[model samples]
Target: MPNQPKTPVKGFRIPVDLYDAALAKAQSEGRTLTDVVREALHRYIDAD
Candidate 1:
């Protein structure tokens, strides 16, 4: 069987200063902060 990630999710908060600019940018783009952060993290960690 293939390994799989655990589910039934949990979450934590980022320090406001860590991504405050990104949150503001997300608001300007009419995106939810969560959506913006999720996309950013996806690209970031997936990068070679």
Candidate 2:
């Protein structure tokens, strides 16, 4: 449904190497990996 509030989701799988890379990038930016993922999701939705 449109305008539905986002709820937490878990257990989405990625390749181990990609996950590690994202974690490193997030750490270098001084943000939790969750925060980085959330921001990316928001930007993607906003752009659509």
Candidate 3:
């Protein structure tokens, strides 16, 4: 099957403390900040 095009990228500002915390956790876990945030958002939405 052909690959689908990815969604366009978007940017938003977050608090410095939140970014720092996500960066630290991502580094420790060997993952990107995007990965951490995506997982977090998925869990949050699924909790509804």
Candidate 4:
């Protein structure tokens, strides 16, 4: 089988402040918004 790209999941709403902060952090670190959110969610899930 050939390598495949992952499909992105969407349609969640977040608070404006949280979105702004994440956007700012992503910009500062030169990363995509998806990358930042994915990392954050991974950390959150692993913390339990």
Q: Which candidate is the best by lDDT?
A: 2
In order, what lDDT does every prediction score? 0.76, 0.87, 0.87, 0.86
Point to the candidate with the largest TM-score. 2
TM-score, each model? 0.49, 0.73, 0.72, 0.67
Q: On residues 1-48, what C-alpha lDDT tens digit does candidate 4 reach at each position?
A: 139587667879999999999899899999989887778899999999
Candidate 4: segments with Cα more than 4 A from true spot: 1-4
lDDT of 2 at 9: 78
The model with the greater lDDT, 1 or 2, is 2
Candidate 3 to native Cα RMSD, angstroms? 3.4
Give the per-residue lDDT digits (tens) of candidate 2, residues 1-48: 359788777768899999999999999988889888888889999996
Q: What is the lDDT of candidate 4?
A: 0.86
Model 2: lDDT to the true structure? 0.87
By lDDT, highest first, what's the ranking?
2, 3, 4, 1
Residue 42, model 2: Cα distance from true site in angstroms: 0.4
Q: Give one clash count per candidate, in the order shown.
A: 0, 0, 0, 0
Locate the minimum summed-lDDT window of 10 residues in model 3. Answer: 1-10
- Measured by TM-score, how close is model 1 to the native structure? 0.49
What lDDT score is found at residue 14 in candidate 1? Answer: 70
